[model samples]
Target: MLRRLAPVVLSLLVMVLGVTALAARPQRSAPPHTADFVVVAGVAGLRWEDVDPRTTPTLWRMAERGSIGSLSVRSAHRPTCPVDGWLTLGAGSFAAWNGNRPAGGCPQQAVTVERPDGTGAKLPDQESVVHYNQEQLPWGAVPGSLAESVRCSVAVGPGAAVAAARPFGRVDRYAPALPEDPTQLLGSCVLSIVDLGTVAGTTRAQREAAARTADAQLARVLAARPPHSLVLVAGISDTDRSARLHVAVADGPGWERGWLTSPTTGRDGYLQLVDLAPTALAALGRPMPERLFVGRPAVAVDGRPDLADAIAKPLDAEREAANQRAVAGWFYTLLAAVLMLLAVAVLPLLRRARRHAGPHGPEPVPRRVVAVVELLLIAAALAVPAALLADAVPWWRAERPGLTFAGVTALLVAAGTAAVRFAPGYGSTLGPLGAVAALTALVVGADVVTGARLQLNGVVGYSAQAGGRYAGLGTVGLGVFLAAALLSAGWLAQQVRKGWRPAVMVAVTGLAVVIVGSPYLGADPIGAIALTAGLSVAAVISAGGWLTVSRLAWAVMAALGVTIGLAVLDLRRPVGERGSLGRFLAAFGDGTGGLTLHRFSTSNFDTLVSSPLTVLALAGALLVWFALLQPWGGLMRLFGIYPAMRAAMAGTAVAAVIGGVLGGVALDVAGAAAALVVPMAALAALRVLDHSTDRTVPTSGRPRGVGSGVAGEDGSGSDGGGTGGVGPLGDGGPGGAGGATGGRDAGRVQPGTATSDGPVG
Candidate 1:
């Protein structure tokens, strides 16, 4: 008994140690933050491409001397406007005015300013903007929180005043424009913000002119004498009606010569606009008020030898992220369409096969036709992972990115499907499904353990522009992996002895969940919860016996235990260090859990209605319940014969439901998984029904893939005429599905593809 459990225990122990090492990794701590004075140069719509030595010399030099990163300006709303950007920066969290503004380039920066005294100004209407962000929006942003944290502050322009004003809309010191010698104004306070104005234009010439103007003002501001100061430059928001990565530079005492990053965005050299407030407050030695800030202080990492190259990574991401937003919608719609087409085409065939079966035997399905449909089903399942892997190539930079991406993805799906169709043990019914599921799991899992580079701008992955996740496995990716891994694990459990099946299922699924829940890997606590729930259900069912209320209770209890354990582990880390699960736990503990839930619920609702993935999820669900599980569907017999496969499908479905809601992206995660697996399930049902009444199934009377019948289960070949040419690829493995003429039994059955009239355990 001890030897039997040794592998599972050892494997689990290894994974735990790996997670511990990754989580305890050194947090980015800026060196003491000794600079007492902080200067924030707010440059709206500044891209790295716009920075030139001749036209924007000061900004160019600033990048060369400091830590540089691309800024993601996601505020309380989509397309963070200039005003929204300024307020978010001020509050150190997502905030939006939600005012009526032009749909295109932002309206000219405006604020109703009243000069209270010679050196002070007040924007009366600023109070309204603050009120709207706090009272109406999900993010409870206090606009002047940055100023209120310190004793005094200075604002140079209208935009600067938006950031520098205290909560009541009052600016301690304000100036309409930069003074020639601003030493006194800058030295009078610990913090100073200068708006370099919007750098934007439809034409190249106009942009260059605007760049020169902002550059001149920036140069003058830097010329002022202020000792022991930190200078920060951020292209704070999106403009021209598009969201793109903007420049972020910090030239200060401890922040020189490195990549700028923060814990909020696990990816190096990328930080959000909200990070600016914490950066300023940290430098000035001011405490960040709890619940008022959502960003962490920026830290510098020294790795990139060339600043231009480091900055280019985010710039490329900007392009790829945009391209994905454009192409992914079309891809999901295509996926849903294909799955629907499969249903339209397969349903009739399955019913026809079933209706023709008589007591003597079942009607013979042409092997050629069966093989083709099986091949098509496999191809369909590969689409989701193929799209994600397609991002490996820089197709986004092509002249026609949308077309190029489609071509690349189609080729990948074709190649992967061909490989799976012809692989060894092709005759096994679970062989093909298991192979594809394994591929899906490997692609998503390999990407995360290796830094999630593929997921950064992956078509099926999360978007930085969306601002929900900057790094770690995305909710969609999590769903895909969850379904694939559990299915593959189910296939594996069937390969072992019946008594050992549950142990194997738990080990495989649990390790995958740990990777998913780890702060350093999947970086999604909520996903872990979903995975845990799925794993518990799968392991329980694999132990044998049909699902009962008591069994369901046991699964739920196991999931709850895992959820609490993960949250506790994550909360041990510092604020912003915890992943999704930890953050939710912390919020709930502090009485803000309701707000977080509302925020997630709202996001989920939006995705539920707007995303095409919802159609795919519903399709998968419908197929599972209405078609496969029904008496007319014919797949119900397959489940009664082989409960392990049933366990896999059940677990994936349960996990998908939990993930769809907790993941905040609604059906996208679950939909991708369903799109991948449901087609495969439909294909299996067709295969089983095709041979249900056949008289040539060995007469062994042993249902294939049940109890001890799974190993060595021979699958019938697709081609009909030959005695036994290998499964789809050619020259079958012992029982490969192939050109079928006369095999030993004349009818090769997939893993449990044959029906069993005996009672299930």
Candidate 2:
């Protein structure tokens, strides 16, 4: 009982302590000076020979108002060093110990070194840093760096103790203690810090002063600033074109002091400067978990998020570049799939539609010619102002601005002109001119009044915003133009079916401008209106082209059926703002924009309708060619001249019967069988009946009047001397049942002749 009670008491005590800590924590707030945040990163200068303050603002900005310093690291005594600046910033470590790079190549022989106090030290040369393991500096303890957690001595070895007590280091002492918790370090670890000046030429006093400044600045900011939201600019630059980085806190106005330095070698100075980025971002409310030597930020920061309330940035430049290269293969594959389907469905139709359009076939009007004409019309209309009204006064221009709507509006006006010109008898120029003038007035008025209206609304609603210049009047005018064009074409097609071809051409012309001038639409009603108008124009073109040859009623019924089906399919697709069918329809009603329905499944009927008018034209082609069987003995009968035709027909019938039985029966299959067999059988039966009748008639069945000295008793002709084979009318002339005579007037009848009301002989 006491054991259970003890556990309960301990848990309660822990919970209360946590509650107290939570309540006692200070409220977090960003310092005032960080209101206007800016980030300045320093990379190795590409033009180191000409490095200047103007060229290296990141280094000088801190150096001018502040100071500069170098740092040192315990690296292999070689030359070249390469490590990311950010990694050095994180864990406050330098490449000397934290990073895994040697200065240059290993020495060729054993080398001797003099310690700071001039004591002799000797070591054999090696090819890699692995050889320096025994000689490596015991920088300090890192709390979590060890595989096994173990306590470490707070006291350094005798030689190292003297080194740690030095006032500062331009290169050596600038870095932070390694193995994070110096007291817990069981072995050596990499250290990180600011760069003091180089030890090669700097005095002890100068390096010591730099170190004190660095330490004081760090302490001041860390104490006063909130735990979050800070930036530190601590680094070194020299009169020469060389530079180094250091550590300093950036909080509020109070701690805006300068840099610190150390007396260290020039090579070590460069090694220590790589730590700035990771440390700065870490202090500024960023997570830095992973440890890297130079540029690697800590693992804690997996992704870079935008400022708390700022608009998100675009995709990372590196990621975008990689994706562009990857997407090309996929794009080409989709294109190939669409093209293959088009070829299979369209080739047959083309062959058929052209079958009976006379020689030279039905010529396809080149899309290029229409495109050129449309472009010329737009250019000419736009050029009018350059010739006449460009410099006109603002008010006058607004009242009669001919150029603004000229590109799209001109084509409609021209089409209307051509319509009147081509119409029989009731043609005039006034109709088109009046239409253009009215459209211009409506557009100009809307453009001028929108600002005033918006101002009035702003007074009342506080947030009323006038649309952009081309939005109000321009879009409304465009909508009206497109609607009128559709209505006019519809009417013309009704009047004369052939006239519908021109309407199709005109709408297709408008489509070119929409595709080419998409950028001009802007970001408001104007763009939306343009999109709607472009699509509606395309629909009209499709509808008009279909109407060219098909009966109007058939075309209308098909269009209506297709429109409803498309609306349903669109509703089924996953929808958000752009793809939502409900919103698309609403937008259509409001005359703003609309959505196009793409084809889903394949059905012959669906293909014939949803496909271009080109397909219907092809179907007509089928009628022109294969349909010859209707006029000239149904093709099977022609083939019937060969007895094999009968066998083919019988096979078809058997297949139809089997299919019907196995498929649970379909009326269509039985009807199909009848269509295949009945006509050929009827024609065959007619020929057989005519042939049998001819055999029954006789050639000498006619009488010779019974006298007058001839072969017969009448001596005109003899029955035994008469010709015998059948005559043209099957030997069954009007004179007698067994008659077969070629003469028309002497008891003979003509063959294959039709009487007044019917076929007769």
Candidate 3:
């Protein structure tokens, strides 16, 4: 044993020594002045005019030593300041391809087309398609190819310094294709990868953290400096004030038209963002890629050039008209319709309070306030449907009228009536029923108009028309449906408060709608469509649970109807499709294929069974479910279960079962797991639940610690002359009861009792 221990100790010592020696070894140093080339780039939301020369002396110094010019950005689709900044520094072709073409010709990107005779599809392929922004960073692709093109030891990416962590290397090129829904995308959409402004400007605390992260990245780049390094420094010099300047530096100095500068008065604008990329590439001694460069870099122009001289000149009559027609005609109409519905529904709630109250009457009950609040909540009801509609529209057209008006009016009316009548109260089964009817009508309408296809593609737009973006109207419709469902649920909850039967009726009504509407809205058969519908249903249900029953019901009903309406819209097709139900259903699923009865057993089953990560996620979810179980919980009590522990366990089991169903598991396995796992997990998780339950005694239990003046535990008499009770410290004294204890001694007495100074004492 001693011999063996000795050898082991010796080995450990050697290992430690080896590690120490390795750590002490000097690191290899970068070669000095043996650079092939250096490249620099800039980022968006910045302009040259706004940059204070004194604030950025290093940039000025570099400019004096090297060439500075305004960079022209070339983009395939709509003009994107961020993408242009990132790609200009990515690789170079020529000035002509820099995304700015005076003639606004065909996009630099390759196009594919099929022959009229259907022999084969023709592919106008280019040498290599370089996606400067979207691909390199976020997608984690090796940027070595980009580096090799410039023959540089290092390549710095383009991004706003204040806004970027590294550089603006990755941007959402598809943004132009996104829908133009002010309420949905512009107002509420949080596409993090695409919206760098939000990411950078999240909060003061977050910005500080981001700044630190950026500093660390800069340090890393400096440490890894190779001979032929490409340093692309892009970002706003400072965005704290009104004036903001964008600067991009490629290489160190002395590159032709390499440096670009942009200035903007506002924090975020387009022009400044467009100047950073090509300038940086020029610094690297590589000509701007023909596919990207359109004209001169920003700094190249001593003053702002005429609009005509800019690389991205306006399109001529026919092209511009065609582009305008796609959105201005149908998209604007949809936006108007959705906006109108919102205006009509929300404006009435403010008036409800005045109508319900009398000048001198007692204050309204919590229920009445809830009713008033619900009326005001029309905006919330409209929001989800608008989002759904936006998702339904394709990126190309993005906006269409068909999706906006679909079921919106009926949903609004149903929600309004339910809200008003139930003021300080809640909706009844009738409201939800009405909502379901409205959604059904809309769905039926879509189906009929689509030629009886039953394929539910862009029907309402929000229903998942796969591979499409910017379907705004569908989003609005979905919001309506959810609002309706939530309203129904709230109404039932209120009924339950008054009497269990009414609540039960309301719940049943909502469940019925879910069962029926789910199919029509493509929430059942088509996977993607079903997913959205189910989520909408769940969201409304949760919302109803949060507020008072009456309030909940009205809100839910409005939300539900809106959600369904939004879910059925299709943006790719025109408004004419709105009047056709046959085409609508055909889009949901292949009509010729009928309903895919075997999908559950085949595709869905196979996918679920094969993924281990999915299985682990399911397990984690089960743990959370068990952790929330409570037998005597309010939910269980509402259903008549008095035992809290039992109720909690049952809830857990139900939750687990639901989770399993959502995870698309086999019924047998889900059932078995629900039975075995839920009970055991619930038992283990009971500790947390037990702690959360209130431990306070009932109001009638005892007179809360007797005041100083009161004697007996009942706290009835004055301390001065009444029978005094034992003091808190248990000193049996008359003064201790009220005077010494300071209850009645200081001339203070209980509201109904007179002090010793008064005759009553």
Candidate 4:
């Protein structure tokens, strides 16, 4: 027994060592030099293509003379509102802000403010600070906006001025235009934020005209600044569908005229809004703060004109318009396919029930048809992962996302077909399902272990351009789908053998959960909780643990213990080192937990009602449940026949449901959880049907495999050979006469019988 356990124990030890080594790696050091001054110009809803030399010559010149790239300005939470974008820019972290209500009428006494560090503090009631109404103020501005600055920072215009002054600090606000020769103002402040409010107009024409005006203003500001000062002009929000991609241009000391490469994305010509603060700080000779920020500095990269043009081309009005339509069309198509598959699974049951007239069973489906269905199922299973891999394909870039999606799907289908045809035992009852589920877990788990490189560009993974999550398993991929894969794989593994097989399967499942849930690894708080609860329960059952009320209670307790323990550990880290979970706990500790809870609840409800994919997923889940309870009783019989397999399935099913519910309540979209439950339930139903049909026996007379005169001690052919008769194994009765009996008989083959050659019914 000890020898058998050695491999599993050693594998776990190696994984632990790897995680420890990752944790001990050296941190990024501070930059060697500081910029004389930093200039931040905010142009809300400005897109790269909007800056033409004809109308906006000054802005065009800036792009020509500086490093230019598309900026991802989405917030950490859902909706990715403008408020969230600006707050992320200020905080250098994924931050949240609920709009503030005036405490008192008129000038508003004691305004409430929320910060990215997950703290809420009431600002001192000063008339100068309370000058603007909530509309004039950026949606999530808190007290001490400029408090993050190490030295003097100045703000100009209503937007930038209010954001800088709201935070608890002394900020000089210039609502009026700057002086023509403002060398003193440029020299005194380390940071200067100028808000180009002309772009705030609602219409495209107005905004275009405003852009030209803002360009002239920017030129004046640039001329007034010292020569060595670093200047950044950015668009903080999306003006319209065509303007969804924000614009950023940087120039001055240590920066060259070329494309921008952000450490956050590791890609040239792309930057996130959260990267703004850290990059600014770095230019001011500050170390990249550990843990608190999610972005890195956007550095100048020369000789990448082609790459820059390719990245910028997608922002063109024509391309953006096409991509929007493609996204919507693709989603509906995928949803339709899932619905069609559900229909295919249920049609057979309905037909079987309708034809109750005779003993003639329905004609068997042809092997070719069965094979095709299996391949399609495999294709569906591989969809997300293939999408992830497709990102690396040069032809599959964002400019032609719809075509890329189709190409990836076709390639995966072909590969899955080849696997089914060439791989040994893949056509067996449990083979395809088990292989797909196991492979899915392995790919996703490996990606998490290796820093999610594949997942970073995964069509189904987190979007770098969206600014929600940069690394780790996303809400949909790891949070929902991966959890299901682990459970399904673990359950299928149990059906193959007993003893150490189940133990090893359970151990691997547990390890995958740990890797995906680790703060230093997967970095997903809600995903960690969902996977831990679901996989832990499934693992326990796979290892031969019962699901009695008491046992289930303990499993739930254990899952909760693990979740709370991890959260507490994260909370113990310094504020700068904490992830989303840590920040959430800090908010809870600061008496602002209710706000966070409300945000999640509202988002979940909205997603459930509004998302077409989520509605279809819910429908699919209901169909699976209906099929399981049908009078044919395939699911019920399969469970009774295989005790250990039954335990694993039941535990996993329960966990999936629970995890789905929790995930919906906590994540940005409820669809992620639904994605997990639907596929798992559907596959389990398919497996049951595949095995059950081959093992059904006649209700009267001698069974097919039993010898004609074989009799029990009762002097009858094995308990009268009726529906209530003992099975061929002489152990089970009635409903258990199918594959369950065959399985038992296979182990005790009698001589001079066909039991060893084929299934005994």
- TM-score of every candidate: 0.90, 0.18, 0.24, 0.71
Give the higher-TM-score candidate: 1 or 3: 1
The TM-score leader among the candidates is 1
Model 4 alpha-carbon miss at residue 590, Å: 2.7
lDDT digits (tens) for residues 467-557 of candidate 2: 0121121222222223233223322222222223333323322332232122222112222222233333233333212223334444344
lDDT of 4 by residue, 581-604 (tens): 666677668665665565556656
C-alpha RMSD by candidate, in order: 6.2, 34.7, 28.2, 8.5
Better of 2 and 3 by lDDT: 3
Candidate ordering by TM-score (highest first)? 1, 4, 3, 2
Worst 10 residues of 1 by lDDT: 705-714
Cα lDDT tens digits, model 1, 1-761, are: 98677755754564455345334433555536669799999888888878878889998887788889888999887778888888888888898765787665566656777896888888787788888887788877788888888899999988888888888888999999888798899889999998989888888888788888988988887888388999998988877678888988988788778888887888888898999999888888788888888888888888856666766777788889989998988988888898889887777667665424324544546678778888889999999889888988999999999999999999999999988978976665567888998999998899989888888877888788777788888867887899998998888887776567777777778778867877678777677778778877887777446788988898887778666655567789777456656677788889877778788888899999998988999988887787776665656645533457778988998888888788778887888788877987887666555544332333254444222222122322222212222221222322322222122245434433334322111
Q: Rate the local accuracy (lDDT) of all candidates.
A: 0.76, 0.26, 0.30, 0.53
Instruction: Give per-residue lDDT, candidate 1, residue 162.
Output: 87
For model 3, how does the per-residue alpha-carbon lDDT over 1-761 read when each residue is reduced to its tens digit? 87445533543343233223212211212112322433232334333332323433444444444333332233222233343333333332211112343242222232222233331122121122233232321211111123333321221121321111112222221122123331222212111111122113435555544444443343333343344444444552223221122333334422333323322100011223233433334333454433222222333222323322321211121122233333323442443344334334322322221111124533423445444434433323332223223323332232433344334434554554454344431232123223332333354334323332222223323111011111112222322332233333332333232223222322433342333233223222122222223332332333122234764565445444433443344323332222122233443454322222233344346545653323423543443343222232112211111111222223223333333343244332233222222222322222111111111111233233323232211122222223232222222333223222221112332323332322111
Which is better, 1 or 2, measured by lDDT? Answer: 1
lDDT of 3 at 125: 18
How far in Å is the alpha carbon of 277 misplaced in model 1? Answer: 0.5
On a 0 to 100 scale, what is the lDDT of residue 519 in model 1? 63
lDDT of 3 at 640: 19
